[model samples]
Target: MSTQTDSKRRGQAFAGAFAGVAIVVVLAVVFFVVRNSDDSDKTSAAAPPPVATQPSAAPAQPTDAAPQPSEAAPQPTAAQVNTPPALSKEPDVKGGTGRLTKLVKTTLVPGTGPAVQKGQTVTANYKLVKYATGEVMDSSWSRGEPFSTQIGVGAVIKGWDEGIVGLKVGSRTQLDVPEALAYPGQGDLRFVVDVLAAK
Candidate 1:
């Protein structure tokens, strides 16, 4: 009876030890599975969202469309180029034989403004024509700019100094300048001057 009891006791001890080892292995496997699942959740939560790309613009294609019309530049009128105001006739200095010894002034249109005095600045529009040829030499109207000068102070030719004095603003006058008072060796010249302003 004692031998049987000893054998039974050894068998029971061995069974308890085997059961403890099985429980330890199951706990280790459960720990590893839980740890791996937590790592997967963290990795998925930390990932960045995917970006969307924009499409590029297409190039323009050539077409057979007609162009739009633009405004045209203005052409000069014949009156503005060749003719003066209707009040005065063109000068006839070409037929004269003798040298121009005197300065001649003809008021085409009389002005209502104050008289032009010596040392006063004047603004005028003038057309200069050669006396012999009647060719248009220079014109302030043609250039679209008025001429400005101080009068009676030798700032201009002696003809202008003597002729333009005592003229009033808004008057149109003709000056037949002699060679002595005109440009050097330019001969007699005709000027149709319209006095616009004087100070």
Candidate 2:
């Protein structure tokens, strides 16, 4: 009976020792897992955020050449053409026999510039008068502005196209337009023109 009781006591001690070892193994596993989790969180917290870098400014290059003077563009000068004589008032037409049958051009003031070309635009001031009555028909001077038109293009009277061509800029001239070259069915007319510009 003593042997059997001793054997039973030994068996009970062995079972309690086995339970303690199992508990120790479980606690060790839990402690290792908690420690690993804490270590991962600390590592994540200690890590620094990515930093952005700014670009550096480049150094300026030096030039060896001396400073030069800046030049301005040249401006066009007015042509050195002849200036016309000043007129005090409009001219009077005289009734004379043997009136001009063709266009008659008389330059009152000569020009020093190039002669007017065909199809070139011309700007001028003019006075138109009836040949027989000396009545002023139209005058640009009274309107205070010059007129611009392409000469020798039938834009004006035939007499003006035929007579005004070959005249230079700044020329002052008198034109006697015959009946055929003047307005339709109109009598002979006179025009005093001051050529201002041509282009």
Candidate 1 lDDT tens digits, 1-199: 9999999999999999999999999999999999999999999889875531210110011121101111221223334332335423433323234466799898978877788999877767677766666666666565554556677765566777788899877788888778676665566777777776677
**What does candidate 2's lDDT look like per residue over 1-199, in tens digits?**
9999999999999999999999999999999999999999999999985541210110011121101111221112223322345533444434323566988888887776678898876666677766776666666666555556666765555677788899988777888878677654456777787776677
Instruction: State each model's C-alpha RMSD to the native.
Output: 30.3, 31.7
Report the lDDT of model 2 for residue 124. 69
Clashes of 2: 1
Cα lDDT of all candidates, in order?
A: 0.63, 0.63
Candidate 2 Cα misplacement greater than 4 A, ranges: 1-98
**Cα lDDT over the full model 2:** 0.63
- Pairs in clash, predicted candidate 2: 82-112
Residue 23 lDDT in candidate 2: 100
